[model samples]
Target: MIPLLFALATTVAGPATPVDPTIARFDRCAALAKADPAKAAAEADAWRLGGGGLPARMCLGLAYAAQERFGPAAVAFEQAAREAEIQRDGRAATLWVQAGNAALADGDAGKARGFLDRALALPVLSSAQRGEAFLDHARAQVAVGYLDAARTDIDQALALVPRDPMAWLLSATLARRQSEGPRAAKDIAEAARLAPDEAAIAYEEGNVASLLGKPEEARAAWARAAGRDADSPAGRAAAMALAGKADAPPAP
Candidate 1:
């Protein structure tokens, strides 16, 4: 969410003849949201009362997100998005994307789905931004057990952002879940190539290799995952998986 907000802020043009005071404040507030979320949230509230408009609301959302208070973050982002829409601001779609991400983080996949779809429905997003929205929508679909819907959205994301390792990783995971072993293998291979050192990708590579009946490859991948970060969830899971299967006979 910080990355998204920063990206948006970087693209805003400054005021006439000099720097835009509001934009500068927004930028400073974004930094504060990362460095001091509680203070940022308090200042953002005061800024909003002083008519700081979309930027103030967005900073408020960012502050909440930084604190992992995702429900309030989603509410703030949604309000900003709605106001942006009313103003016909081109940034409205991106704000909606932020709201959707916050909703997803808060474990409200249904709400996330609607918000992400709203972003996708808008034509204001760049190709990369649209791809991101689709990818997030796919995640929301997955959270709600709509695997088929997720597959469609993920495919769209890949079409637009084929270079994104995360997209390939999700595609591979989805393929594996659907029992499409060959597709899973292909997707996971790409994901591994793109993000060779990522423990999560390596862990998924192990899963895909196992599905493809390549126990040796699975073990090797899992070993790499565990070696990469023994404390991480993926690394720990990979270590456990490798231990469970290291001496087992190959699947028939």
Candidate 2:
């Protein structure tokens, strides 16, 4: 779940403008996360040399997060949020989202909620921003055991961006948590439809199938997911589940 926060941050883009060195470094770090986190951290360190602006600080926060340094990540994100506030840019909403995620990763649901609330208060955010905020809020709600609130937020996010694979994945996650197997399956299926190349959706579908007692279906879905992104958490979970049932074999 904490990793999902990282995923959310990776998907969001900042405003288009002259390349702010901090944001350029942040983008580079984001790109490196898929290939080489060590390189990403090095880039973030370089960005830090220019000395802590909102984007640079946020990149540092994410770099720490990628390294599983949650405490420092949260602190960096908090500082970034303060800086963004001082700058009073609407884009600061994105920083708030990142800070909320860092807080969530650190197991501070109260802090997560506070940061998410600030993100939601941003005036006239674009649909993408609103969707991201709702997604982060949904994740925070889930952390706090507010199942109903999580459902509402995720649903709203999906409505705002029906084609977003991550939104559907979040919906599937919420449904699974509620023990609504059919709904989870539906959400995962939609995610697969929207993002045919995304292995995560296939892995989610596998989980839904397994939960619904369709072991053969789960096996097939997991296999497809594994073929797409062998390193993703979804792929790992599917592989682990399959491995546990290796002796018994998948049901026909």
Candidate 3:
């Protein structure tokens, strides 16, 4: 699964093209998804059958995803991706990546991996899309216990998005999982530098410090994390860590 910390700043950049009327309509439907998912879904479905094309199907998928109906979202995105492929549209890579994300949300990591691999193979994608795809692929690798491969994927992601806090966070997490304390500490420090107010980064900083046997550093980091938002799960976990608990539960 992609960590919430990593997902926080990620947004899909829209395709680079002049907004035609159809795409404008699709965008409107996509915007309505969060506020009125049912209505948006119904509209998208109706549009799909009335020459609405791949964009309408993609909009329908987004509506389903907004409702947390990930299974249907994945199916819709897959269909849209296939249609895009048939038309030789550059947008197929984006659709495939969206399919991968929905499959991940639906708890089908294998399918997610397949979709992401296809996305990565596509010749057309912006650097941002390729970087995000690598991150998503790394998540699938992590799910299947392929830590080393995940590390490689994350490195690729970082190369494309060097300034992204989430990239550094993921790199830190992968390093920690591999017991590379110094690397984890360095990467997490970079993440904290990029997003100083992120409680999750502080929490992970504490974890890395603790793993390196720096009690004072860990305690200080945890205290900062706890103070960020005391009611949050990350804050609660930070509090626990600062208390020197040996077996604290994982943070959200």
Candidate 4:
């Protein structure tokens, strides 16, 4: 699930402004973003034109993200981050992370790396937030083939949030990339334990099983993933594996 940045209680950094009643409207738009992205985006756009400011643009960005229009969402979020910076708001780091996440989703690793670098340079992030930032930055690094740097970032993330399934999954994936079979198997096992129902975890377990020379275990794990959600990428990959196609690397 996407982090709810707007709902945080951190004090805004600029001169105090009276709470705008329109904030409720933007919140409503955001609340409906996934369920009705087109409507939410339209509402947010209209509000932005009427001088709704940062929150309105953020709502629009979320709406676009819900529709998987990640490139446009990154643009909106980057704009909001710049605006927040000019106002000296503490929300700048969160906005930068959102932009980075959108860019990553859009498969623009360079932009994601730049935005995440900005977020990490900010001093306002809480411990948990910093962990997430590191994990995301690591994802960007992995995309750009910086495996060593990704390992360092993910190590920091795991230090901060040891039980995070995503972080474990990423760790396992990176271990696999580095040809650390024992570590990959161990980490993927932890990820699977943490998120038993996650198709991606099952798929990764299969990968680790294959690497460990347990073909039967790999087939079983892959079959489990394929049965769980046939339309998902993990499911498709599992199916491909079952069809004698060469196994590919698991997605993060």
Candidate 5:
């Protein structure tokens, strides 16, 4: 998965074109938002009220997202997207994608799906951005139980950004969920190769091993996951999985 920093900074640069005033200001505000979200949000909101336009609103959304106030962030980003759309600005696509990601973070899968669908319909996104949009769309689909659709979108994401370990991880997870043990094992192996230190990937690798009835491999993978970061969610899960297996009764 894209870290919060990458997710927020994605709106900062792209398009090969020279940076304009709006983008400059957006960049400045995004930096401040990461450092001081409450202050940034206040300033951005005041700027919006003073007719600072797209950049201000985008900054407000950035500040909210930095604070993990994802519901408000989604609202702010969607409003900015609408503003950009009316003016025929290409940034509208990125804004919509940001809104979708925020909504997904807010646990509103249906709303996130709607926003992502809008983002994908726009023509201005770069190929990489389109791949990320597809990846997030798959997350939305997964949240809403649209597994088949999520699978298709993940496949598209993999095609576009095969180097992205997160995409491979998600594909492996979906394959495991669908009970395709060999495919899950293969995908997770690729993910591990790309991101050997990621606790999440190690934990998933353990899961794939377990699914394939390779308890020794599962135990080793889970041990590696816990060793990487015992405090992270995946690490904790891996530790628990190892514990449960250790306590299981022996077969007759």
Candidate 6:
């Protein structure tokens, strides 16, 4: 699993103006969210005091989501969406994506679908944005047990960005769920090749090894994953696999 960074590169950057005090505070909150949730929460309060804008609210929402404070995250995202609408800056599409992500994090699949559907309907998004939206939409589909639809959406996302490791990972997981073992293995291998440093790829490799009845190989793969990022999803998965081994009776 990856570190779940907010992918700040997704935001458009231009010539740097003198940083607004509020935006600067928001950035501080974002940084603290990765290392100290309590400090991030304090910074978020300061950001609100500085007069929250759409970007500020979104950052706060991301911080909350990262800390698993889903309810407050949803509220912040919702406020950002409304502000985008009022501003008529054509940022509604982006806001919808943010809202969808927050809703998904909150385990509100219906709300996620509603926001994602609106985002997909927007015609002005760049190709990369569309690809990201498709990938996230596929995730919502998978969460609701719409495996086939998730597969199709992932295929579309991959077509748009063939080199995206996450797209390949999503496709691989969907294939595995569908019992297409060979296809899943191929996809996971491709993703691993593309992102050799990503712990998630190794975790997926461990899963494939387990599915193929190679327990020792699985353990080795998961160990590699756990070594890369102790706080990542891959590390948690590896720990789970280790626990399972401890619970199983010794082979006769």
Worst lDDT run of 10 residues, candidate 1, spans 243-252
Clashing pairs in 3: none
Which TM-score value belongs to model 3?
A: 0.85
lDDT of 5 by residue, 98-152 (tens): 9999999899999999998999999988888888899999989988888889999
lDDT of 1: 0.86
* RMSD values, in order shown: 4.1, 6.9, 5.5, 3.7, 5.6, 5.9
Overall lDDT per candidate, in order of appearance: 0.86, 0.72, 0.82, 0.86, 0.85, 0.73
User: For candidate 2, what is the TM-score?
Assistant: 0.71
Model 3: lowest-lDDT 10 consecutive positions: 1-10
Report the number of the highest-TM-score candidate: 1
lDDT of 5: 0.85
**Candidates sorted by TM-score, descending order?**
1, 4, 5, 3, 6, 2
Kindly indicate the candidate among 3 and 4 with the higher TM-score.
Answer: 4
TM-score, every prediction: 0.90, 0.71, 0.85, 0.89, 0.88, 0.72
lDDT of 3 by residue, 7-81 (tens): 111244587744567757876888778689999999999999998988789888888988999999989989998
lDDT of 1 at 165: 90
Model 1's TM-score against the true structure? 0.90
Give the C-alpha lDDT of model 4: 0.86
lDDT of each residue in 184-217, candidate 6, tens digit only: 7899899998998888778777777677677898
Stretches off by above 4 angstroms in model 4 are: 1-5, 8-19
Residue pairs clashing, model 1: none
Model 4 clash pairs are none
